[model samples]
Structures are given as C-alpha cells and as structure tokens.
Target: METTTATPWLTEEQQRIWRSFLGGTTVLMDRLDRDLRAAHGLSMPEYEILVRLSEAPGRSIRMAELADAVAHSRSRVTHTIARLERENIVVRGQCSEDGRGVSAVLTDHGFSVLEAAAHTHVQGVHDYLIENADAQDFIAMGRIMQNVVEQLHGKNF
Candidate 1:
C-alpha cells in the first residue's frame, strides 16, 4: 500500500487546544469590548488606538503610522479618526512637512478619557481574566500569543 506524502491534519488533542484558544480569545475580547463600551463608551480598537497615540511622540502619530501600529486599515483608521474628531477627543492636523500626510493627536480631553477608562478596563481584565488565572498561566498565555502573533503578523503587518 502506498503511503500519503502530505501530512495529516491536527491530532485530536491539538485540535482541542487550538479550538479552545480561538473560542476563548473570541469570548474574552467580546467581553472586554462590551465592558469597556458600557463603562467608557470606547471600543477595544479605539482604546488601543488611543493608547498607542498617547505613548507616541508628542502624543501624536501620523495617520498611516497609527494605522500600522494598531494593525488597522488606512480606511478604517480614517473612519475611526472621523468619529473621534466629532467627539472632540482626537484632533487631526495637517503635516507641515507633507501636505497629504495627516497626524492624529490625542487631545487633553482624550487623555483624560483614556485615564478614566483605564481604571475600569484594568478592573475588568482583572475580574474576567487575571483573577481566575494563575501567574504561570498568564505568562504562558503571553508567550503563546507572542509566538503566534510573531508568526502570523511579524512579516505582514
């Protein structure tokens, strides 16, 4: 009998772990988004954008760069910036060096909102994820995620 050259699919245990990771990540992010939205009116993506901008130089970054850092599409970033601009939380400024380039700057009010939301967000993370998880488990999770993210996104994004 001829044997197959191609490798077979995941073993049952491998499948179980992979599926658990997928489903758990989905649920965790969903819960986080919901909690942040209810408590702070900020989506997870928006919160990430704010955090990145807050830590960047002058509390601002070019629009395209911001999108890259957040792993969002340029168009999606624009839409998000528009919404934030409307809320007066973030401001868009023309890049003096490049007229076509725009920068998203987090306003003082935006910083305030982020600071306030951070407390609730952290508590939510602690309640939903950290409180139930062991330190070793948490570290393992980070390492696993780091490996996955590096493998998947390091080259492309």
Candidate 2:
C-alpha cells in the first residue's frame, strides 16, 4: 500500500496569468529573433553569444564560460561559434594563461556587425516591449524576474 498526497493546483486567475506569460514571452522572443535574422543575418542565440564575448575582457571568453553566460549548452555554443568562424566574425584560440583551454574571440568584423545589430535589437526591444509597458511596470517585472531567477538558481530544476 502507498500513501499519496493531494496535488496543489493554481487558481483560475493564476493559471490565466501564467498562460499569458508563456504566450507573451514566446511571441516576444520569436519576433526579436526574426527581426535580428532579417536585419543582420544573425540568430538571436548567436547575437547573444557575440554580446557576451564583446563584453568580456579582450572581447574573449572560455568556451565553457561563454556557454554558461549565455545560458546555452556547450555543444550549442560550439556550433554557433563554428558558424561565426566561417564568417570571420569569431575565432577560437588557446587561452593565454593556461594554453590548454579554448576561448572564443570576437573579431573586428564581429564587433562592427554587433554595433550595427545593436541598433536593430534595441529598437525592436523598445518597440515591442518598452514602449508598450509602463515604466514602473517594467521595473517591477524586472524585479519579479530577478526573484524568479534566484529561486530557480537555488533548485536543481
């Protein structure tokens, strides 16, 4: 014999809000990706990787750290870096300190591309999200998201 506990479920309002959040985020991300692809020939994930590398010291970061910073898997980051490498946008080289670890370095071409893409990305973000939401609401949403991130970071899931 087994004992079972009752499951706790969301209230109607909570369920509705949760669904709205899921749908809204999906649409927002898709639009952003599409906009970036159309304007810069770069996918959102690749653009994110470039942004991370550009911000790092000497515009470079170790492969593993880049994946972690972008919240992507190592293989995924490697694949994207490979594509960038083909386009002369990025290059992978030995880390100077260890000479054993690999790092992704953004090229001059990549920086120029990123500079152009930033305008498109910023405008899209402003048009799609910032302009629509009240300033206070946006700030509150950021706080809520930060709390959510903290909670998730504490758990395995």
Candidate 3:
C-alpha cells in the first residue's frame, strides 16, 4: 500500500502572493482569450494547438507530442482537435511509421486563418501586456516564466 504525505499549507503572506499571481494570470489569460476569440473565432487553447501544428514539420505532429507541447491533456487535445477537424481547419492522419500513432495536420485554409489571426493576437498582446509593463519587468517576467516552465518539464526547447 502507498502512503500519502501531507504537504504544508501556505502561510498568510505566501497565500496572498500565490493568490495575486493566480488572479493576475487568470485575468490576463481571460482577456487575451477573449480578444483572440472575438477577432478570430479561436480560443487561446485552440490557437495554441493550431500554432504548434502549423510550426511542426510538414505542418503535422503526433497527437501525443502536440498535447505535451501545449501542456494539454490528451483527452482535451482530442476534443479540441475534433472541433478543428469539423471546421475543416485540421485533419487527422495515421502515422506511416507506427500504425497506432495518430497525427494532426494543419490544412492550407487553417494556415491562412492563422496568418490573419496572428496579427490581431499580437496587437492584443501589445495592448494588454507589452504596452503597460516596464521593460525590466517584462524581461523579468519572461525569465520567471521560462524558469517555471523549465522546472516543470525540463525540456530543451
């Protein structure tokens, strides 16, 4: 039988900082997602999924690998892919090397959509994050996020 260890809870100050971080990130993400969707009909997660697939070799990647790249669960990726597939923006194909492996491919129409949407998304990013933040703070934030990502996945990107 496996025994579970109880972790210590956050102190008042720690909790405040944690909540602040969570709140800020949540609000920022919501705003960005809203902007992207309003302008391009793509949720942030869907946009990220599409972007990753677009950048992949031959505009295709294994479903599992794509899920990992975007930090999405396999199931969530599948559901989102189904939606994209219905839109004719993406297609699923069997891997030639491994019969069991599935790959997501971005269609030409999808690429066109992404190219148009990226402009608006970048403008939204500039308005929400870049325009307001101090240069040093922006740099610091990138470093902090990079470190957190590295610690979590430890993958060379």
Determine which window of 10 residues in candidate 2 has minimal summed lDDT: 148-157
- Measured by lDDT, the strongest candidate is 2
lDDT of each: 0.91, 0.92, 0.91
**Model 1 per-residue lDDT tens digits across residues 1-157:** 9977898789999999999888988998999899889988999999999999899989999998998888888999999999999998899988888979999999999999999888878888988889978999999989988897778763664
Residue lDDT tens for model 2, 26-114: 99999999999999999899999999989988999999898878777789988999999999999999988886789999999999999
What is the C-alpha local distance difference test score of candidate 2? 0.92
Q: Which one wins by TM-score: 2 or 3? A: 2
lDDT of 3 by residue, 33-119 (tens): 998888889999999998998898999999999989999888999999999999999999999989889999999999998998888
Residue 29, candidate 3: Cα error in Å is 0.9
Q: What is the C-alpha RMSD of each candidate to the true structure, in Å?
A: 2.5, 2.1, 4.5
Clashing residue pairs in all predictions, respectively, total 0, 0, 0
| Candidate closer to the true structure by TM-score (higher is better), 1 or 3 | 1
- After TM-score superposition, the amount by which residue 15's alpha carbon in candidate 1 deviates from its true location, in angstroms, is 1.5
For model 3 the local lDDT of residue 128 reads: 80
